[model samples]
Target: MSGKMIDTRVTIDGTFGPFDCRLDPRLCYTKPWFPLAETRKVAARTQYLAYKHGNSSTETIHVIEGRTDGPDSVHLIEGVPGRNGTPAVAVRIRWKGARPTATLGEATADARREVTRKATARRKAARSGRTGAPRAVVVHIDWCGLGEDFDEAAFVVEPSADGLYPVGAPEWRWDFASWWCPACQDSQPWHEVTCPCGLSRPATPLGAAGWNAGCALHCLTPEATSVLVDLDGSARIVDVHAGDTRIDMDRHAEPFGQAEEILRTALAEAKPGELAATGWERAPGRLWGRRYQITFPASRP
Candidate 1:
């Protein structure tokens, strides 16, 4: 299918003593089906799978009371009632683009928290005068958030402070800290560190950079994206604003050549705070030889 194909749906409903719903062999090595591992288990057992995909989309799927043997098809085997005690379950598979399902969303959120925890732990470990080297934290830069206004941000994963990482929205505020409840085997923010079962856990310091970068990214305007790059093998974003020329966030996805020219011109001639835009404009050449232009769009429009 072409890239324009945004949404597709598939339904699988059947029962058998034992059968295999084989899939593309290439995907075995690729992680295209990841993040949905848990959801696939639920969907497979419930005999229902609903997926949706788009630039920014949500998904809803049913989870039945069943568990998979492994993260892959190897775990889907089980015993059957009859047929010489052969496996009773059957596998059905389908592929879809990256659509956020409840399971996948939860996984992403958990990953985000783990990343924050690891980064924070590394920073804390460095400051605590610990003997061991800080945890190896590798930050990933991506354009996330919802809608066309998606901006660049970083994420990484590490162990939870109390060795417990829960699934849900992360608490990344400056004052948020993680506390573990032994009774529940889960973690919570400092405010609710006390479990309903009367188990109260002590708070652990969260790294300052976690909340600092989060808050900074959130406060940036939608029209302005945080430009992150991997230069010299290290991921970093240098926030250097041109005095007179502003980066056009709308055209952030344009070709590399166009973006390079804009950057070159802005650096060479743009005064502080100057605005720039990228679009098509007629050039002083053959009638059909118009070229792309960069200038401020009409303010009134």
Candidate 2:
């Protein structure tokens, strides 16, 4: 199944049969010099209609016309399979024209207003338990043609929160490259560590560690006082004691299944300063032995 658009005509090669339709003139508009200036006009003229085959047959279902204005361009037509499996389709026509520009003050004000509106809507949806529909996966096709000469490219479109999917186009917030913080629910960049709400980023493993280390310390008797193990396979360790640490086998030699055996042996036979004898370097944090938190690569492993 596939779809193509040439000027105002949209054609869909559906499962049951081919669908042909023309976009309403009101729903189509010239890309304006100032997008916001045309926002109200486009919003007022937006239309939606469903197309089906014979009256008795209920197999074919397609949204032939559903127009909406987006941040980048206007979505002229969007279609989704109804009951039977049909490929999702989107037709976006970007007219060749000069790019639009706006005054700094106008752009800033519009951005602020849009942010506030989206934030408010997200909060309301959270309270009402409405997360909207999940993004849809589809095949996107791009074509350029002049007379008989044309170039075409097609790629699979994976589901993402930032993209305008056929199923969730109406609800897409246009917050590209950003995510909702779990702590405050405010949208933040994916790379940001601390959110404006004063929440510190949670700990996550940087990458797979070559070596596995298990440390055990005993204050009295043979029983272990504190035992620490690197189970996450990350290169870093946090909130661990810096006493006699035992560097175990490389992760490849001994899988995590032997973690219990490794822990038992370290607690029973390992002693302090054994790590240094193996020529493994140690760089402890400010509170080294007391509240040890260090990140050192396991070069030998």
Candidate 3:
């Protein structure tokens, strides 16, 4: 505030904008180059860094769209540009590492693939009349700790009554097979899947067993006892990430904790299931100790 105004330009995409990167002495003292306290102070300020910093340095115009997560996406831009005052810039921004999710394109693509795969499996199940919905793998959860390798240490996916029918075969494709849409939400084309919120449904094909491979996250279930969790749904689930991590095959992998959080949040916002859990107990381990049981929401005709 004491110094005379100095003109500086920050480039975004192809546009240049005003910026001030002059290291504030107060802020500079907290440089990582220094020790403990300094770094902590800097860290606190950095914890809320905006993408504008990157946009200023690298001259990249990154615009985020949508609500409920636009700002979060900008968190992807971290680190200073490798080259200063250069038309081009470089930064080892761990876009994925910055958050617990993939890019929009990545998430959508993965969802599309999952939906198709599930449709195929469902079609097969329907041929066999596998009326049996995905079973919930009951895991009594306990303490969760990140391994030294930072791998998932404790996790379990519990069946929930968020009642998000996975995207499935179009009604014309699956005969006599219909999914639940909230109480009376407008229905989509997919009969095997529907959204109670009337949001877009899962894109999984009808009768497909999309859960054959992934189980990345775990959701705590107080609904039913000794049940397996299904991965396909109309909402964001850790199961997709779980399967990506080979969680089901690797008993050592602990992803149940993340899955539980996902389910908890979803169920908390959703209507209570008609099938209430009856029993409760704990699992034997350093984690997954306290487990509960309740019934699942009924499926649509």
Candidate 4:
């Protein structure tokens, strides 16, 4: 049994595989009359139980009822069911390398460790007077459009002591307002000459700074006629049916005058017809007004 190799086989239910045999002569028994079918069933059941109990490998040896028998008397069998009256073969199974199941204490300790980690994190956040996650600040700018036309910009930032959140720079500057860069669509301070994407700041009408830094002028008349003048010097006249009339006309009067003059001159020279004959496009959906592009005359120094 120590050095000699014995041919061994294992059967679980009906599955079969090669088995390595390790027999001890001290546990040998005398060969009794065992029904071949019953012996096979017992051996298979023993191997299955060893596996279900977490044994990685198992070996079943056929032996008779005896205290000390030589390895010759003990035989390693493979699916052989002898006759009913034949010498009964008792199976001796040895389970190898079984993994111990986890104890209740170990499982409880793991759960406790997880709870402690979460408690520590919550305590840290409480001490700092902040949640672990940063808050999202959504700046919804409605350019007088409804539903799908509403533009929304969101910023995820760490909350500051003051309720106001800083835009581009760490220190907020009141002199310049934040404007969106046309090239990259990133918000930048108004005083920035060039965007990070290398796009130069577009020119705006005089006095069109602060909140109106990147605003398009929507000039409305009492007759429901409106002209939309963009910062790029493009103008479009559209007939507006309904709109908000709470515009800060007094604050934007100077910029409106400059934008209106540019549009008036461009229309007169380009179309050369009555204002009504210029073909006002109907724009009922334009809550603010329709935006049109026009070229500004070169400034003569």
Best by lDDT: 4
Give one digit per residue, the lDDT tens place, for model 4 in 80-133: 223432121112211112211111111133444554564565455457654222
Residue 170 local lDDT, model 2: 17
lDDT of 1 by residue, 46-137 (tens): 23211123211211222222112111111121222233332211222111222111111112434544544545544554576545321211
User: Which portions of model 1 miss their true places by more than 4 Å?
Assistant: 1-218, 221-230, 240-301
* Per-model TM values vs. the true structure: 0.14, 0.18, 0.16, 0.16
| lDDT for predicted candidate 1 compared with the true structure | 0.26
Runs with alpha carbons beyond 4 Å of true place in candidate 3: 1-191, 194-214, 217-254, 273-301
Instruction: Count residue pairs with overlapping backbones in model 4.
Output: 12
lDDT of 2 by residue, 213-282 (tens): 2211111111211223332332222323323564332333332334334333333332355433433334
Q: How would the candidate models be sorted by lDDT, starting from the highest? A: 4, 2, 1, 3
lDDT of the structure predicted as candidate 3: 0.25
User: Distance from true position, residue 21, model 2, in Å?
Assistant: 40
Better of 2 and 4 by lDDT: 4
Top model by TM-score, which number? 2
lDDT of 2: 0.27
What is the Cα-based lDDT of residue 84 in candidate 2? 41
Q: Is candidate 1 or candidate 3 better by TM-score?
A: 3
For TM-score, candidate 2 versus 4, the one ahead is 2
User: In candidate 2, where is summed lDDT lowest over 10 consecutive residues?
Assistant: 10-19
